[model samples]
Target: MAATGTARTAVDSVMAQLSALEDPKMRAVNERHGDDYGVNLSRLRAVAKELKTQHTLSVQLWQSGDTAARLLALLICRPKSFEQDELDAMLRESRSPKVQDWLVNYVVKKSPHAEELRLRWLSDPDPVAASAGWALTSERVSKSPEGVDLSELLDAIEVDMRDAPDRLQWAMNTCLAQIGIAHPEFRNRAIGIGERLEVLKDYPTPPNCTSPYAPIWIAEIVRRQAGE
Candidate 1:
């Protein structure tokens, strides 16, 4: 469906708000991450909240191709309204890791077809789709592991993680950590896999920050859960 006149007007207003709030420093930071626009999340969200329109305005804003506008579009887009092809297009168009992460976390995971897409994309040749699939799988593992085959996921991580694409490798590592934390049946095996893979083990985490190193992250969460 095409955006209506009202949607166009809302898009214009949002663009104006974004322009008014532009920060060169923030833009530079965003550019470093593949975004070209300067609007911050807080400001964009405030504008979205003020507009009180989600899908229609989101469609228009996404078409505008402003980095912040596209991010906001992800925030407001109706997940159910988007087809798998459209979601794939969005992933392909996402130039930065942040946008891709937001698309997975905010829009794709919320879709009614999330599980279907997750499974379909898991083995997809496209790196972005595969990475998103793993990310979605990780979210599922965290929220609801009852139906997931923990053994199968572990096998895939063990076999393919080392050679996977960069983003997919990150997601696979996260999936390993999530499996360890969320599924007691596979906790030991997950930790073992993490220790063997040694993924992100030397990534240098700051003080008081939990390392993304699967072994450490899993151990900490498991320890916390056990009240140790």
Candidate 2:
């Protein structure tokens, strides 16, 4: 009873703090990314720092269904404490790009079920889930290429990337770039596929930032790795 009561108090207190931090202009900017709240990451991190890790409080915040609260929940929660299905449900429930990105990066990556979920998500018809799969695959491509079928990944990217939805397309492009950057064998093929697909070819990249265009992205990262 004491633990439960503490969880409730924590949830209520954090919710109020989150409400006080809301900003209309920030929300307007976040809305472009499908997020509804405006508390910037620095402020959000400060909030998380105070709360520390609290799984029950995180669950309540996630249940509240506010984007900023969900982001905060992700930061303050114990990542590997969640069950596989719970993580899957959270990812699906995450409507905002920020929420989904945070879940995958901060939570799922740390979960014991990561590989199982990664394989399942890769074939999921939902673009967001599929994007998660690709994102995980990119990690594997860079870190553990022993068993991954790099050629098959490239073949799929070649056939599907040009017409993938916005978020999925970006994820697929990242995987393609990762393959080229990590493996010398597939570098030429990945670059050729990116050049042909022209994915993110004309993206409005800010000056001094690496372009997301996969070929350029791949080339630049590789150049830096070689101390060029």
Candidate 3:
């Protein structure tokens, strides 16, 4: 959608706000993750609050190519109006893992076409699409599992996980943990798969955070949920 003159002015104002709050140190950190923004999340949200017209401004900001602005744009964009081609373009252009995560959670998952995209992208050869597909599946299993085939998911995890790309591996591991925690009937089976895969078994985890190692993470979550 083309931004009107007034909308362009509003976008420019918001960009100015973001630029004023930019932090060089934060920008350096973001650069490590492939994002080119110097602005912090809090500052971006502050700008988002000031610019209430999300849909209009999102279009302009997304076109600006500023990392912070694009993140804000995703927050304000109308999920229902988001098209598949636009989403595909965003995913293709996303180099930062953080941006991809926001796109999956804030935009794609909230869209009306989420399930359709999820099913199609899960098998897509592109790593970005496939990773988003797995991430969406993980979210679905956490909230609702009515139609999802647990058996099929488990089978895929068993067969494809070791050979999956880095991003998809993380999502698959999370999916395994979600299944174990959300469906008690599948807890043992999920645990067995985790044991066999040993995914993230040797990966370091920060203190106070659950290890991404599926078996340990699943067991810890299950224990806590059971009031242990």
Candidate 4:
């Protein structure tokens, strides 16, 4: 009966693990900070691996069946480092705002898929995606010998300001403050957007849109551009 007892113990362990799934609130926070899951990668990968077989949990988390769960799953899955094709699938499939935030934020700082990012910035339906696209463009311009063309980027910003979501508009404006200053071509555009800072002071402003030191930066840019 020792073999039978071992089987029961293993079954019980699996059942207990299943029972430990987090409640909704905890899961939401986990989804929010999913990219920060630096330590939980192995466990998350194991769970994701099992879901590919079982198909229940992965379906609930990644598909339209449950947005929060889907978001958490992507957030959890994101840190494990997948192939470019896998990442493309996730980007194509994911529609969660949280996931969008993570993906766009990733593009701003990383360079693995440079051309793809530029394309997405130009054409993505989601404002966050577009905002991230421009932010990534600004980053490329800042570093590349192309020297960060202001006219096109500013025109894109103007389009976003008029037609895109406020979140994306705010993100574009914020990135403008930080990244657009290096090039002289964007000086007039920078001042023009900076002039509108007063209109964007309302509550719905995206985080980091208005730098605490933006006025100082604007003055500096204006002075430098004018040869003062």
Candidate number achieving the greatest TM-score relative to the actual structure: 2
TM-score of 2: 0.97
RMSD of each: 2.2, 1.1, 2.1, 8.6
**Per-residue accuracy of model 1 over 58-177 as CA lDDT, tens digit each:** 877888877778878887778789888888888888776777888888888888878888998899998888999999899889998768888999999999997887788989999999
Q: How far is candidate 1 from the true structure (C-alpha RMSD, Å)?
A: 2.2
Residue 30 in candidate 2 has what lDDT? 84
lDDT of 4 by residue, 144-211 (tens): 62644567666666555544576566666655665546655665566676565542534354464534
Worst 10 residues of 2 by lDDT: 32-41
Candidate 3, residue 32: how far the Cα is off, in Å:
2.2
**Worst lDDT 10-window in candidate 4:** 35-44
Choose 1 or 2, whichever is better by lDDT: 2
Residue pairs with backbone atoms closer than 3 Å in model 4 (clashes):
61-70
- Between which residue pairs do clashes occur in model 3? none
Global local distance difference test of model 3? 0.85
Task: Give a tens-digit lDDT track for model 2, residues 162-206.
Answer: 999999999999999999999988999999999999999999999
Question: Which regions of candidate 2 are displaced past 4 Å?
Answer: 1-3
In angstroms, how far off is 228's CA in candidate 4? Answer: 18
Task: State which candidate has the highest lDDT.
Answer: 2
Ranking by TM-score: 2, 3, 1, 4
